[model samples]
Target: MKKSILVVEDQSSQRKIMVEALQKAGYVIFQAGDVQQAIDLINQQKPDVLVADMHLPNGDGGDVIREARQLPGAPVAVVAVSIDLAILNQNLTATYQADAYLSKPFHPRELLKIVEELVGVSH
Candidate 1:
Protein backbone atom coordinates (compact mmCIF):
# COMPACT_ATOMS: atom_id res chain seq x y z
CA MET A 1 0.00 0.00 0.00
CA LYS A 2 1.14 3.52 -0.67
CA LYS A 3 2.29 5.35 2.45
CA SER A 4 0.00 8.02 3.87
CA ILE A 5 0.99 11.46 5.14
CA LEU A 6 -0.83 14.01 7.30
CA VAL A 7 -0.06 17.66 6.74
CA VAL A 8 -0.91 19.93 9.64
CA GLU A 9 -0.53 23.50 8.55
CA ASP A 10 -2.77 26.48 9.23
CA GLN A 11 -2.13 28.26 5.93
CA SER A 12 -4.39 27.15 3.11
CA SER A 13 -1.91 27.65 0.32
CA GLN A 14 0.90 25.89 2.14
CA ARG A 15 -1.25 22.88 2.96
CA LYS A 16 -2.39 22.62 -0.67
CA ILE A 17 1.17 22.86 -1.92
CA MET A 18 2.37 20.20 0.50
CA VAL A 19 -0.50 17.86 -0.33
CA GLU A 20 0.16 18.21 -4.05
CA ALA A 21 3.86 17.57 -3.73
CA LEU A 22 3.36 14.56 -1.46
CA GLN A 23 0.68 13.14 -3.73
CA LYS A 24 2.99 13.46 -6.70
CA ALA A 25 5.62 11.63 -4.68
CA GLY A 26 3.14 8.73 -4.31
CA TYR A 27 1.82 9.38 -0.81
CA VAL A 28 -1.83 9.38 0.19
CA ILE A 29 -2.29 12.89 1.61
CA PHE A 30 -4.47 14.17 4.48
CA GLN A 31 -4.70 17.78 5.65
CA ALA A 32 -5.52 19.61 8.87
CA GLY A 33 -5.72 23.34 9.44
CA ASP A 34 -5.33 23.13 13.19
CA VAL A 35 -4.86 20.73 16.09
CA GLN A 36 -8.46 19.58 16.32
CA GLN A 37 -8.68 18.82 12.63
CA ALA A 38 -5.37 17.02 12.78
CA ILE A 39 -6.33 14.94 15.79
CA ASP A 40 -9.66 14.02 14.25
CA LEU A 41 -8.09 12.85 11.00
CA ILE A 42 -5.33 11.06 12.85
CA ASN A 43 -7.75 9.12 14.99
CA GLN A 44 -9.64 8.02 11.91
CA GLN A 45 -6.89 7.56 9.34
CA LYS A 46 -3.64 6.96 11.23
CA PRO A 47 -1.27 8.19 8.57
CA ASP A 48 2.18 6.70 8.08
CA VAL A 49 3.87 10.01 8.68
CA LEU A 50 3.12 13.55 9.79
CA VAL A 51 4.37 16.88 8.47
CA ALA A 52 3.28 19.75 10.67
CA ASP A 53 4.08 23.36 11.32
CA MET A 54 5.38 24.08 14.81
CA HIS A 55 2.87 26.83 15.45
CA LEU A 56 -0.80 26.18 14.70
CA PRO A 57 -4.15 27.94 15.19
CA ASN A 58 -5.74 26.24 18.20
CA GLY A 59 -2.66 24.41 19.51
CA ASP A 60 0.92 23.57 18.64
CA GLY A 61 1.82 20.68 16.35
CA GLY A 62 3.86 19.09 19.14
CA ASP A 63 0.66 18.23 20.94
CA VAL A 64 -0.56 16.30 17.93
CA ILE A 65 2.71 14.42 17.62
CA ARG A 66 2.61 13.51 21.28
CA GLU A 67 -0.90 12.20 20.95
CA ALA A 68 -0.11 10.26 17.78
CA ARG A 69 2.74 8.44 19.49
CA GLN A 70 0.23 6.65 21.68
CA LEU A 71 -1.78 5.26 18.77
CA PRO A 72 -1.39 1.69 17.53
CA GLY A 73 0.81 1.25 14.47
CA ALA A 74 4.45 1.51 13.65
CA PRO A 75 5.55 4.71 15.38
CA VAL A 76 4.64 7.54 13.03
CA ALA A 77 7.54 9.67 11.93
CA VAL A 78 7.16 13.43 12.01
CA VAL A 79 8.72 16.39 10.26
CA ALA A 80 8.19 19.61 12.14
CA VAL A 81 8.47 22.80 10.09
CA SER A 82 8.71 26.39 11.16
CA ILE A 83 9.41 29.85 9.75
CA ASP A 84 11.28 31.12 12.74
CA LEU A 85 13.85 28.40 13.31
CA ALA A 86 15.41 30.01 16.34
CA ILE A 87 12.21 30.43 18.27
CA LEU A 88 10.92 27.03 17.25
CA ASN A 89 14.20 25.30 17.92
CA GLN A 90 14.40 26.94 21.30
CA ASN A 91 12.56 24.78 23.83
CA LEU A 92 12.06 22.18 21.08
CA THR A 93 14.12 19.63 22.99
CA ALA A 94 11.72 19.60 25.93
CA THR A 95 8.69 20.64 23.90
CA TYR A 96 8.44 18.09 21.05
CA GLN A 97 9.73 14.85 19.61
CA ALA A 98 9.72 14.47 15.85
CA ASP A 99 11.84 12.44 13.45
CA ALA A 100 13.09 15.55 11.69
CA TYR A 101 12.83 19.34 11.42
CA LEU A 102 12.63 21.66 8.42
CA SER A 103 13.02 25.37 8.70
CA LYS A 104 10.46 27.15 6.52
CA PRO A 105 11.09 29.14 3.35
CA PHE A 106 12.61 25.75 2.45
CA HIS A 107 12.32 24.37 -1.03
CA PRO A 108 9.69 21.71 -1.63
CA ARG A 109 12.59 19.44 -2.49
CA GLU A 110 13.86 19.66 1.06
CA LEU A 111 10.55 18.64 2.60
CA LEU A 112 10.14 15.85 0.06
CA LYS A 113 13.55 14.52 0.94
CA ILE A 114 12.57 14.31 4.57
CA VAL A 115 9.37 12.48 3.64
CA GLU A 116 11.29 10.00 1.56
CA GLU A 117 13.65 9.43 4.43
CA LEU A 118 10.87 8.95 6.94
CA VAL A 119 8.91 6.52 4.75
CA GLY A 120 12.05 4.65 3.71
CA VAL A 121 11.30 5.21 0.05
CA SER A 122 13.37 6.41 -2.83
CA HIS A 123 12.45 9.80 -4.28
Candidate 2:
Protein backbone atom coordinates (compact mmCIF):
# COMPACT_ATOMS: atom_id res chain seq x y z
CA MET A 1 0.00 0.00 0.00
CA LYS A 2 1.12 3.53 -0.71
CA LYS A 3 2.11 5.46 2.37
CA SER A 4 -0.17 8.37 3.29
CA ILE A 5 0.95 11.85 4.33
CA LEU A 6 -0.84 14.78 5.95
CA VAL A 7 0.51 18.28 5.23
CA VAL A 8 -0.53 21.03 7.65
CA GLU A 9 0.36 24.51 6.45
CA ASP A 10 -1.48 27.79 6.80
CA GLN A 11 -0.32 29.43 3.61
CA SER A 12 -2.23 28.23 0.61
CA SER A 13 0.72 28.36 -1.77
CA GLN A 14 3.04 26.61 0.65
CA ARG A 15 0.49 23.90 1.31
CA LYS A 16 -0.06 23.40 -2.41
CA ILE A 17 3.63 23.07 -3.04
CA MET A 18 4.00 20.37 -0.40
CA VAL A 19 0.88 18.48 -1.50
CA GLU A 20 1.97 18.41 -5.13
CA ALA A 21 5.47 17.38 -4.28
CA LEU A 22 4.40 14.50 -2.06
CA GLN A 23 1.74 13.41 -4.52
CA LYS A 24 4.30 13.28 -7.28
CA ALA A 25 6.51 11.14 -5.10
CA GLY A 26 3.67 8.54 -5.05
CA TYR A 27 2.40 9.05 -1.52
CA VAL A 28 -1.25 9.66 -0.82
CA ILE A 29 -1.54 13.27 0.35
CA PHE A 30 -4.00 15.02 2.67
CA GLN A 31 -3.82 18.73 3.43
CA ALA A 32 -5.16 21.16 6.02
CA GLY A 33 -4.62 24.88 6.54
CA ASP A 34 -4.83 25.10 10.31
CA VAL A 35 -4.41 23.15 13.50
CA GLN A 36 -8.04 22.18 14.01
CA GLN A 37 -8.46 20.93 10.50
CA ALA A 38 -5.18 19.11 10.75
CA ILE A 39 -6.18 17.47 13.97
CA ASP A 40 -9.50 16.44 12.48
CA LEU A 41 -7.74 14.88 9.52
CA ILE A 42 -5.27 13.13 11.75
CA ASN A 43 -7.99 11.44 13.78
CA GLN A 44 -9.84 10.47 10.65
CA GLN A 45 -6.98 9.38 8.39
CA LYS A 46 -4.22 8.26 10.70
CA PRO A 47 -1.65 9.09 8.04
CA ASP A 48 1.70 7.38 7.91
CA VAL A 49 3.61 10.64 7.80
CA LEU A 50 2.83 14.20 8.86
CA VAL A 51 4.56 17.33 7.49
CA ALA A 52 3.46 20.34 9.51
CA ASP A 53 4.45 24.00 9.40
CA MET A 54 5.38 25.32 12.81
CA HIS A 55 3.26 28.47 12.62
CA LEU A 56 -0.43 28.12 11.82
CA PRO A 57 -3.67 30.09 12.08
CA ASN A 58 -5.31 28.17 14.92
CA GLY A 59 -2.78 26.97 17.45
CA ASP A 60 0.32 25.53 15.74
CA GLY A 61 1.85 22.47 14.15
CA GLY A 62 2.93 21.19 17.53
CA ASP A 63 -0.70 20.57 18.38
CA VAL A 64 -1.15 18.54 15.27
CA ILE A 65 2.05 16.59 15.90
CA ARG A 66 0.91 15.76 19.41
CA GLU A 67 -2.44 14.57 18.20
CA ALA A 68 -0.84 12.28 15.63
CA ARG A 69 1.57 10.84 18.13
CA GLN A 70 -1.19 10.09 20.59
CA LEU A 71 -3.23 8.07 18.15
CA PRO A 72 -3.27 4.32 18.60
CA GLY A 73 -2.25 1.73 16.01
CA ALA A 74 0.75 2.31 13.77
CA PRO A 75 2.96 5.19 14.77
CA VAL A 76 2.96 8.30 12.61
CA ALA A 77 6.28 9.87 11.66
CA VAL A 78 6.13 13.64 12.10
CA VAL A 79 8.16 16.31 10.32
CA ALA A 80 8.00 19.88 11.57
CA VAL A 81 8.78 22.67 9.09
CA SER A 82 9.35 26.31 9.87
CA ILE A 83 11.11 29.47 8.73
CA ASP A 84 11.90 30.52 12.30
CA LEU A 85 15.65 30.24 12.80
CA ALA A 86 15.28 29.82 16.53
CA ILE A 87 12.75 27.02 16.23
CA LEU A 88 14.84 25.35 13.56
CA ASN A 89 17.98 25.67 15.63
CA GLN A 90 16.32 24.06 18.62
CA ASN A 91 15.92 20.30 18.64
CA LEU A 92 12.29 20.09 17.48
CA THR A 93 12.58 16.38 16.96
CA ALA A 94 13.14 16.07 20.69
CA THR A 95 10.84 18.93 21.71
CA TYR A 96 7.85 17.88 19.61
CA GLN A 97 8.64 14.22 19.22
CA ALA A 98 8.93 14.74 15.50
CA ASP A 99 10.77 12.28 13.35
CA ALA A 100 12.52 15.14 11.53
CA TYR A 101 12.62 18.90 10.97
CA LEU A 102 12.98 21.01 7.83
CA SER A 103 13.51 24.69 7.41
CA LYS A 104 11.17 26.67 5.20
CA PRO A 105 12.00 27.36 1.55
CA PHE A 106 13.42 23.87 1.49
CA HIS A 107 13.62 22.02 -1.78
CA PRO A 108 10.88 19.53 -2.55
CA ARG A 109 13.56 16.89 -2.84
CA GLU A 110 14.52 17.56 0.76
CA LEU A 111 10.94 17.08 1.91
CA LEU A 112 10.68 13.93 -0.16
CA LYS A 113 13.85 12.54 1.31
CA ILE A 114 12.66 13.14 4.85
CA VAL A 115 9.30 11.55 4.15
CA GLU A 116 10.97 8.61 2.47
CA GLU A 117 13.24 8.10 5.42
CA LEU A 118 10.37 8.35 7.88
CA VAL A 119 8.08 6.05 5.95
CA GLY A 120 10.85 3.67 4.96
CA VAL A 121 10.08 4.10 1.29
CA SER A 122 12.23 4.90 -1.77
CA HIS A 123 11.26 6.70 -4.91
Task: Give TM-scores for every candidate, taking all chains together and pairing residue i with residue i.
Answer: 0.92, 0.96
TM-score of 2: 0.96
lDDT of 2: 0.90
The segments of candidate 1 whose C-alpha lies over 4 angstroms from its true place after superposition are 91-94
Worst 10 residues of 2 by lDDT: 114-123
In candidate 2, how many Å is residue 120 off? 1.4
Q: Distance from true position, residue 63, model 1, in Å?
A: 1.1
| Model 2 ranges off by over 4 Å | none
Residues 24-75, candidate 1, lDDT per residue (tens digit)? 8888899999999999998999988989898999888888888788889688
4-120 in candidate 2: lDDT tens per residue? 999999999988988998998899999999999999999999999999999999698889999999999989999999999898888887788888999988999999998988878
Candidate number of the best TM-score:
2
Ten-residue region with minimum lDDT total, candidate 1: 87-96
Candidate 2 residue pairs in backbone clash: none
Per-prediction count of colliding residue pairs? 0, 0
- For each candidate in turn, give its C-alpha RMSD to the true structure in angstroms: 1.6, 1.1
